[model samples]
Target: MSWSGLLQCTAVEKNGRTVISDCYYEGALKLTRPVYLHPSQPTIYLIHVGGGYVDGDRYKTEIMLQEGAHLIATTQSATKIYKTVKVPVQQYTSAYLDDQSVLEFFPDPVIAYEKAQFYQEMTVYMKESSTFIYGDIITPGWSESGELFRYDWIRSKLKIYYEDNLKLFDHLYLETSTGMTGIFQMEGYTHFGSLFVISPFMTQDLLQKFESMAARFPASVHLGWSIPMIPGLVIRVLAHETHAIETIFQMIHQFIREECFQEEPIFLRKY
Candidate 1:
């Protein structure tokens, strides 16, 4: 669809403070003002702003975080790319996190229709004491109505601070056809999601804990944990159901809530 609309929301908290702005919808929304939070507050602010498809094939969203701020931004719902008679749909998101800041970008899964093609890229920058959590969900195609598997291609990239300082750089690509099967790739599953966290305090013990949690899920779901050169842990899963994928995402969120937010004042506010 054509890029006919845009929405932008921004939040900032510092110390024990919290500040939120209204959702801005216009040709393009921008957060020129920096939201600040009290160091003691440890709050998370989420903003949902994006373009709803209409007729064009291209849409773009941008996010920026200042120094020492913590924010968790998510879209209100999965972006719908209506099937068209002409070309494939595309959505682009760009994010920036500054020094001593923490950001979690966990949007709901995107459901691709038959013949739909999607490409997404996320880039983050960290200076000192900065932490980030990122994740995405994708389906081979709409499973209802007995559509089964019909998507052409879906690919994504997660890039972080350019240095080997944390060993946190990875790329992912998935394609579906009438052929492939079993455990490693999709194992006959039609839904998949991945979670990545960047922190200065990741360790082998923490990695083990995450792996153990993932094991609680069904065997149909492929779960794995890795400690990349980056200072954080990475957890990935491929499942056959949307609810199962969401359950896994919520589990990881709870883990972060208990482990990272226990002593901090930052609270998770509802969307």
Candidate 2:
């Protein structure tokens, strides 16, 4: 059936600290109480009480960060897409960042069950001085029948705008039943991941540093970096185990935190 959920979070500076002034949710979506891990940054967790997305299920979230505000948004767990007959599971997120704001959207991976169809779209509108980091990981769902890549299809799009000008638009689509060459084929990898870093801080030297960092990963894990056709840095990975990609993500996040903010990365405790 048709189901939709909405969540909105607005942050503003108060008393020398950035705080979530208004937080609200409706329908199957929910949010934990905002946590202040640092003075300028507040952390929020996205929760889906329905457990997983099914056919015709829709969920949306919007985040507004005022000038100089900082926020970290993550999910309590991985988003699961169950089997579907015809309809698809859709989700959307829109974020608006004022001047000099910072946002980190780092959620767990999505596992698509057999015959499942999933779609996700994310849009970010921000000033030229804002900093945003977004990531997505997908893994083949486990099947008792011992079959992999049985899902019908999965599609995702991420678009970012700088002061009304489109700066980045990334789209991806994978179909398991189409017999398409190299669609989900990465030397037998079962999972894939992509990370986007959008900020004025990205320089050629920093991109080279990231390339050097990828060299330390095992040969089994294929790591590639490319300067996106847009105005950002993109890193892609193909791995047999999901944890391998996650470990590298942690390293990159840590490096960004230290280099940009001179602070340690927030280790979110998953309950």
Residue-level lDDT of model 1, residues 1-271, one tens digit each, is 4454444454455554434433454553333333333443223332334443333456556555566656666555666544544655555665566666677676767776765666666666565477787778876555456665565666677677633243455677666663435555677767778888877645677667777777677676777777776577777787878778777777777777567666332223234
The residue-by-residue lDDT of candidate 2 on 85-189, one tens digit each, is 777999999999999888988888999988889999999998888888877899888877998887889999989888988878888888886653364465568
Runs in model 1 with CA error above 4 Å? 1-10, 20-55, 143-145, 162-169, 178-184, 263-271
Error of 2 at 149 (Å): 0.8
Poorest stretch of ten by lDDT in candidate 2: 178-187
**Which candidate achieves the best TM-score against the true structure?**
2
TM-score each candidate.
Answer: 0.77, 0.93
Instruction: Find the candidate with the highest lDDT and give its number.
Output: 2
Locate the minimum summed-lDDT window of 10 residues in model 1: 39-48
Error of 2 at 101 (Å): 0.4
Task: List lDDT for all candidates, in order.
Answer: 0.61, 0.84
